[model samples]
Target: MQKRQSKHKGKSALAEKLCPVCQRAFSWRKKWQRDWQNVIYCSKRCAKNKITKEPKPCE
Candidate 1:
């Protein structure tokens, strides 16, 4: 049987667990399993806004 690690031992950092855009806790699911780290926004709209605000790749 697959064992779940202790919450305190694995991915326990609160800063790494929240969405940067909405500041909401991330809901774990199969879809989010892979992009958990890159998940800055809770939704696509926020992600778009972040990209749009950027003047360019390099200034």
Candidate 2:
């Protein structure tokens, strides 16, 4: 009997994205497959920091 072939023969290339807050390169993940387009920050910490670090308008 012949061995079955896999749908993915080799390692799939992981897409990379830059984090807005940390400014670091991050790779794609299975959990973010559906919402990859919406992902901007690398982690929750960065996301939270982004909200607090926003520049305030002069009064």
Candidate 3:
């Protein structure tokens, strides 16, 4: 006999975002739920690199 299926199974269609640094697609995560709008980089590495590439102020 076949087992019963869950109603919520395979329904977790998470949102996706594009990473500016790697130019790749990334999916939404639970930790970012509250600050999804504020999220920019997909990982810490990307965020760190972002700040390093900023233009320097005039001396």
Candidate 4:
């Protein structure tokens, strides 16, 4: 049997995005295939700890 080729096999860098909450880069995941565009946080913990209020600008 032959192995199937993955569309994202060599596009790792292109499949990554920064998490707004942690300000860290995260790669694409199979579980997020259906909703990759809607992904925001890197993990559940970050999602839970997401900022609720906007920070006030310093004068």
Using TM-score, give the best candidate's number.
2
lDDT per residue, candidate 3, 5-52, as tens digits?
766534257788888887878888879999999888999999877745
lDDT of 4: 0.87
- lDDT against the true structure, per candidate, is 0.63, 0.84, 0.81, 0.87
Worst 10 residues of 3 by lDDT: 5-14
Error of model 2, residue 1, in angstroms? 10
Q: Which candidate ranks first by lDDT, i.e. highest?
A: 4
- Model 2 over residues 14-40: C-alpha lDDT tens digits? 788888888899988889999999999
The alpha-carbon lDDT assigned to residue 12 of candidate 4 equals 53
Candidate 1 regions with alpha-carbon error over 4 angstroms = 1-16, 51-59
Error of 2 at 17 (Å): 0.3
Runs of candidate 3 exceeding 4 Å displacement: 1-12, 51-59
**Per-prediction TM-score:** 0.41, 0.68, 0.65, 0.66
**Which of candidates 1 and 4 is the stronger one according to TM-score?**
4
lDDT of 4 by residue, 14-59 (tens): 5898988999999888799999999999999999999878888899
Least lDDT summed over 10 consecutive residues: which range in candidate 1? 9-18
